[model samples]
Target: MASIVDEDNKKLYIFDEFFRKGMLNNELAQMIKDKGYSKEVIIADSAERKSIDEIKKLGVPRIKPAKKGHGSIMTGIQKVNQYEIIVHPNCTNIQDELDNYSYKKDKVTGEYLNSPIDSYNHGLDALRMSIQSVKRKARILTVKL
Candidate 1:
């Protein structure tokens, strides 16, 4: 958290919302008050890169190489066992099916469509890694009806 601090001579404290156990660094939050420094906080994740230009306008130093599947992926099953509502577009049963994009072809000429396939299913792999890593066996699932 100190690494992200912008200015000098003024002290700042930072804290992670959930994973980091301890008190919030009110000094930094306070310093913004003490010196009247503008405070900017960023909440970022794996999918935020697409909005790079928009995020930069907020005036806070950016945290980069944003992490995915933090608490949820690494400990989601242990934290909240079971899963529901998996959604994926262009998904296929086998990895190779994903590799081939369901073998889409130009209907008119039967020529290869040649759309890049591997990129389509990567998000699902990311989700699978997170859920399976938790290794929870409880069948109870909480849902909104």
Candidate 2:
């Protein structure tokens, strides 16, 4: 859906979306590889195990899995809100999702739900997952060092 290159331009954060729907995992890998991001670290949804496996088969570098949970989602949302996440101008889907995505609400109580409506969330999910993974890895590296 969107990608953010770090200030150094060495790292790339790819937010998955349906820019072209029905694309196979291998095809997607090739497309990313062709774009010269093959060596960059890729943070992908851990829930999509099959697709992740397929991408792994292509030998993409540093394919990190992003764990999804309520806490992680909340944290990711907070991170996005707290920082300036600039998206590429060409990433229309990312812009659209950011604009239109909303939390589900209960009809009777008129209360906002904890989770987001699923329909327009692919890009958002990808972004959240990537943010979570980055945070998680940073913590790990800090602990290790």
Cα deviation in Å at residue 138, candidate 2? 10
User: Measured by TM-score, how close is model 1 to the native structure?
Assistant: 0.22
- Candidate 2 per-residue C-alpha lDDT over 1-145 given as tens digits, one digit per residue, 9 for 90 to 100: 4355353333444344336667777888887677655666677777776776677689665566776676787777776565455655666777787789898899999999887787666767666666555632231100000
Q: What TM-score, over all chains together, does every model reach?
A: 0.22, 0.73
Over 4 Å off in model 2, which ranges?
A: 5-18, 136-145
In order, what lDDT does every prediction score?
0.30, 0.61
**How many steric overlaps does candidate 1 have?**
1
